[model samples]
Target chain A: MASKRSNFNRRKSFDAVRAVVNDVRVLVARGLTKSYGDVQALRGADLDVAPGQITALLGRNGAGKTTMISIIAGLLQPDSGSVELGGIDVFSNLDAAAKLTGIAPQETGVYGVLTVRENLEFFANLAGVGRTERASAAAEVADQLGLTELLDRRAGKLSGGEQRRLHTGCALVHRPQLLMLDEPTVGADVATRAQLIESVRSMANEGAAVIYTTHYLNEVEALDADNVIIDAGQVLARGTREELVEEHRLSGLEFTLDAPLDAAEVERLGATNTEGNTYRTTDDRPIGALIADLGSQSEGLLGIESLRPDLETVFLAVTGDRLDEGAS
Target chain B: MDAIRAIVGVQLRIIRRDPWFLVIMFGMPLVIMPLFVDTIGLSLQAEGYGDASGAEQVVPGQVVMFGFMLAGSVGFSVYREHGWNTWDRLRASAAPAPSLLAGFAIPWILIHLLYQVTLLVTGALLVGLRLKGSIIAEFLVLLSYSCCLIAFVLLLTAVFRTINQVNAIVNLGAMVFGGLGGAFVPVDGLPKIAQYLSPFTPSFWAMEGHRAVFLEDGGIADVLPSVGVLLGATVVLAGLAVTRFRVDETKEFFG
Candidate 1:
């Protein structure tokens, strides 16, 4: 845990320095620390997303992703940090930064009393979109999110997925330079998720720096985004899917027993307890070898599975915990 | 200015879409005015005015009383954004706190003025509430009271973190201020202590202004003190609300 944090600190420090030296990144957030009473939401986190790049903030719930995004979006103030969007300091000149940034929070927020078109136009107007252009902007965003048909429907009356689309649509209506979406697909259906992912990609291609936060590894993979692994309010790793997997590959058998094995038996199998009664072999080991080693205790075996090297494995290797378990 | 305008525009639209709350509240005061207008008229007659009809006391009293109750809706609108989960979205716009509050205050103040006017006209028709004073003076009093009450409720909204807290205070304030400020009866009929305490409530000043026009046949110059007091209170309350309000503050609505 200490080494992972140390490595992240080193890399983040370098990234922060690079961000200062060059203006290549559209959004740069450095050393953000925020605490809510006793709970620290963020701790010296650093992130930089350049134009036309989608960086996925991959973390479980309560992993500071929302807090970081909120700070970047200027919806929050950090204890100590600086956020610059399009060469303007976010906290210093919030209005200017706001004009260049668009954020969709983790929760779906739409003006339910208003029609979808009204919701979109209101947000656009609030974001400084011109009177003459707001209608076209709303219509364009609606088309992109497949919300055109439901534009006149009250947001409260729309289906959950439709409302979700409108919620995301309101963020992009003004065509901000940097877009931050915090778990936009959390409660969305498969079709909605696909549509959102496609829209995110399209936004990036249109030169909007995008920060996408989600717990779903599959979504990250589908976007093929540069992944930033965050846990316990710190950034542990930042790389692409293949890069992360190759850097921290794992191949082992994970076996769960009805009852936990004693330390002696655990040592005999050369396994480490992950959680509960589950034990995993640290080295690449076949199920047959583990079965042979379990011997008499094999009767107590409840489940066994092989671990493949993937983003999930990478997350486990870096954070020493399962993202899927934390997510659920 | 543009941000404030945008906020006002959307808020007015939202209110227009769902105006049942205001409609229901408008009916409440009109119903209560006639119930005790006659008894209050006799109380006024005994107190002196031989030609007094109860409409003078009952109409403005109901307006002031229910207007206090209705002012809470502005506070509710602020907390309702949290319930709708759009508070953060508004914050993301980076609109200054004053702009945001004004955005809300502007539409509700106009609506509140409309509410008072409609009730006054309707009550006058129902119970024959003759406007003896200048119409412009009556309008000024209505506008001042509207601004004053809206500012006070917004101050309460800024101070409280939950709609429940604001709701409790607003409900208690309506009854206490109304009962003390002679909303149910003429101030002369109330106990001396109640009358003394009446001046502290916004309802007291508003009722005083209404009576000036409704009973005394006062013109703009006659009601200037009441209007001045209400507008001054508006400034203080609005200043406090702006100081206390934190756009980033988390306000709970449902829970």
Candidate 2:
């Protein structure tokens, strides 16, 4: 037990050092602008993704996340600016960049008529995996994504969650240096969502640069990574989780009442009214006093909900818009 | 080479998965050619055309008819690729443009070969007709002719947005040439102006080249002008296809 504990500590330390050592940018886009006639999809958007880390692209719908991923994947070209993968221009040198990048698009790009294994094999070959290595690579990806049993099933016949898993597996089969996944865990159950997040974390641990875009604040919370929040085709802010919430000047805390508290009670606690039976108190000093007073008023509080500063509050504070709005 | 193989493998899988494409590729020649050939035979019989072998003309006529069907079917396949958004995916892959073009061309060439062989067998079984030229020489002529037609289809796919427009355009061109270029009736009986215009049609050279081997007393050397025209057409159309091909997902053409 002691040896195992030491091993775990060693592994954790290695991950910490490796994370910082691999912080060099793997993909960089500057002033990227794309227009479809009059509607500008990207308005000088810029992003830098580092190696061996997950960067969550938090945005509302039509915020140009898909457009950014397309340009980085070499599927679309920007009218101005440039995207580079590992110091190579993606659009100008597609073949070279293709070796490093794999994209799991939002629309599920798998061929429905093919089996799950076949889809993985085909995409692996397209990504330059040799024939001899395809089967073993596919098996490894399937196992990592918990899709080993569904390998022979046709992709079209799978459930939405299963299809999403297969799509991620297909992208991972080549073990690409950069993986761009747009809404990777949308419509997934809790178990499947955990599996997807774990798979992504493992990939990052293997030294891949992963860019994940999702509207689900829970997904962003579940992931341990840097954050880039986009709004109106531009970067609103970017940093670590704590840094972003702090920079945005947003605070989060929760209180449980001995009984259903009235608006007067909530005001006495120095918390602002948010909704029915809910109040938000951002002042640290007032929260401490309220907690002390609550203990004195009642020793039998039925429940206490802990709230931590998270991406959702940071998003609302910075963009001045609700996170759920404009999510398609 | 890997890129080429991957593109071709994906395209072949898509083609095989669609039953309608298989029917058009293999069934159209078997079912449609005989109707046109019978109509030609009825016209010849009414005119007291030839000896006991007056039906022999129907055999060569069916071969040329097969050419027209092959051209239209292959051309429409290219248009369908555009409509289905498969072309956009192919372009985004690591596959080179040359490999993609070769992938599309190779399958159509195979379909053309299958149609030619089926036509020959069906003609012999139904009408007691046999090809007059060397089999190897005729195969070369047919392969060359199909390559030229595939190039034309590639050009149409590059320029046209709607499958309906491409179908209408290819069918209209096919009918004009099939009528005037001697696929149905002899061009000799048409007006002098029509006969003069026939040389410009791709089917005109294709039919003349096939007839030179299967109908007239002509060697491989004798069909040089027709071969030259087909090769020239292939080069120009391929050049246009390469120059005009653009894969942009944001274009209005997607709608």
Candidate 3:
């Protein structure tokens, strides 16, 4: 416990120094740790997002993404941490930070009984937009999200995708300086996803710092966002996709056999059995050399494939787990 | 202030869209009030209300009884926000707890008063119910009762984890408080035990103030004590509600 306490103090000091150095960042969240009873949700997690940049926060279930977002949005108080939005401490001055920050939580939360326009304007109004500007703000958000035609209709009557769009639209209607969308495309349709991505890109282009959490790595690539991979409540790695891919790239040969190889044969090939009947080796040897080394065991070979280095491969390398396997 | 105003507007709009519950609440008592009039009139006469027509007892009785049930709607609106998954969005707006509670309290108080007034006016038209006292005094009674009941239910909203618990309590409260506090029968007619327990309920003070207007020809000055009890209770209940309310706590709306 003493060692753990020392490490926590070290992280806090490091975050304080980093906060001072990164003056241009729109959001600086540091040393964020939260726990629910005996279960620790976050442990000294630190993140920074600059203006006009999109940070795709990738994490599996129980990875503390929602908790972190909720803390930043001022919904849940963190056990220990500080979030600064546009240089203002979020929890200390939540009302002022609320005007500068907007968040779309993981759930679809649009008011079903209200018209789309009403839902949008209500959120805008709640965020402190002037009465005269709320109407125009709602219209602007609806037009951006392609909900102009359905503005007058009740939110419940719209399609699932439309409701999803409206949910996101409400968050951005206030034009917050820092926008956090927690899995915005979970149940969205193909078109809805595309539209949301486009809108998010535009928002970033207009100089809002965005933290988007998702299990879909392709969305990260599509948004061309900087990647932050969190697991077990810690941000393990964060960088551009290309940067992460290059830094953590894994190259290997994987082959499946009709039957499991004996321990002797596995050692001979210097390969590890990744799963049933599938063996992998991260050696730089050519496939020809590995196949020749297989010798008589080659007769049992079913297939051979080369692993390509990409975000998925990098994610697997960093977290030792598949992204799709953890996604709901 | 803006957050509170927006929440009030949204809450009122939501109610306007789904108004059948309030309509039924209004209609049910109107039906029951006439049924109990003749029976309760005899009791009021025996109690020495010289010109009592029973409308004097039954009309405000129904209002106070059903008014307890109607006040529960404020708590329901709060839980409904959870059902719709919009509670977090509202919390994320950074509105203080007092602002959120006030937003809900304001509209329900207005609706509660309107509901009671409409019933009293209908009684005046249907059963020749006349106010022997100042109309303004009666309005104060209605206003104080509305404030007190809404505050009480909001405290329940803060303390309860599910809408079902609140519903059960509110339903039981309407009946128990109404029976004990002379909403269904005059305090003089209730058994000795209930009459002793009657003053503990907000309905008792409300009924006391209403009896001053409808039965005793009393002025605002005469009903101030009853109003004081309700307004004082409102302050205590509302303060408790604010303290107990937790924006981060998840409340279940539907079973």
Candidate 4:
């Protein structure tokens, strides 16, 4: 249901460009509109992914990040839209599209009754891996996901992090061309999260297109992925971490005075009093120049810090909300 | 097809890895068989069988009763996948819905057949359960009953949303159908209405076929009626299971 009139439209042109760019662009979804009755889950979400790169989907809880991932992973259907996986229409030919993709959902779902090896090979076999290669494939995936030592162990007996690793391992066993991990590191400990992130990075290095959704902004920096900030079921902005910071970062000065300033002086300094003896100013004037303009009131300034750019800052600036809330 | 095979293999492995249930299924019937043999023997004599120890009746009776309960495990397996959080992973496989359900259904059907067959063999050793009728006909009856009840339970699993719902119906089905079909007593010894209702239960047809094979020394022709009924019920239940089963349906596992 996407109109095709604009090739240079600022807001939507990136999706259009990546849609036709190259076969390396493994996934493309346009005008994805899904609703659960009157409550919309995805209100026209557009996303594209290319090989050897990861795109981090950042959003608050219930902001359609999971909905977008679920749609591409084929667990949910959109009311109106088109999904192309490896240049094949995903909805029209889901079997083929499923062949090209793998998804480790936000929830850890391993067959607890089965051994780690069985769990891996079973998923690989379901993904159409050859019987001859299933064993090696399982072993390799196990090693990659730090599950080699626990191959013979029942998944139910493993630690939570180990189980989480196996849950992600099942998806990558077939080495799908396009991999989507929906907040794979949630609830994982430090070592487990590190191992999974490394494994994901290695998979991408081998040319798999990755879509990683996470609330932990630091993990996004680890992947060095393009950041797509979504809110209220719409794509608010998409750019590199630095690009997002440059574009959406709320440049301002936050300062604490030795004592409370009157509202008149607060207005004279071109600032708003935020809390006890704290003032914020979005004026583009330099801190030194503003302090000079402050004149004798500058002596009362206790601390002055520029609000440095970060993904969290960018997320807050673009969505007017924190990403960490309900995201993890 | 590969997806189905893989799922079946996984399901079979899961059962094999945790086989206490099947072991209990096999053992419980053997224990209950001898206890009911003398009582059901007297019931059988009242129905016209002379000098029968009733092991033939009790063996297949326990087999049918326990077999019905065992088939509920198929539904439990489906719900268990949901409990393990693997249902969505299975859905993500892109296999057709019927194939996915078949993945769980096929292995359990075979296990169910094995459950019944092993009980018959055990009856022969422990309680003198002799096969006086055609071996082929008895095997046919067993296979058809296994298929029928497994399909019926799979349909129930698809139609219901929670394990409690499925367990309630299956547990109730076992006792109600078993009693009405005379697994607890003899069908002929029951009152007129119960005798009439016996034909509607799979246990009735199974007991009819087993009795024909054990007491009347009947061959395939004598057992064809029961076999036809079970196979017919199988097709209908399987069709319903296929029609009602949705891979995306969220089945509650524990609650």
Best by DockQ: 1
| Steric clash pairs (candidate 1) | none
Docking class for model 4 is medium
Residues B34-128, candidate 2: write the lDDT tens digits.
Answer: 55556665665665543224334555555565565566565555555555434544555656656667777778777766676677677677665
lDDT digits (tens) for residues A1-328 of candidate 2: 9965775576567558656754578988899998888988889999888788799988888878898888888888898989988989987789989889888777555667778888888778888899999999988999998889999988878888898898788778899889988888777778788999999999999989999998887777678777888888888898767667656766645554545676677668776645444455666554456568665644545444444457777886778655783364
CAPRI-style docking class of model 3 based on DockQ: medium
Calculate DockQ per candidate and list them. 0.81, 0.30, 0.74, 0.69
The lDDT, on a scale of 0 to 1, for candidate 3 is 0.91
In candidate 4, what are the lDDT values of residues A125-223, reduced to their tens digit? Answer: 999999999999999999898788999999999999999999999999999999999999998999998998999899999999899888888889998
Q: Give the deviation of candidate 2 from the true structure as CA RMSD.
A: 6.9
Give me the candidate number with maximum lDDT.
3
The CA lDDT at A249 in model 2 is 61
Record all residue pairs in model 4 with backbone atoms less than 3 Å apart, i.e. clashing: none
Interface RMSD of each: 0.7, 2.5, 0.6, 0.8
Q: Per-residue alpha-carbon lDDT of model 3 for B4-59, expressed as tens digits?
A: 78888988999999999999998998888789888988888888887899999999
Ranking by DockQ: 1, 3, 4, 2
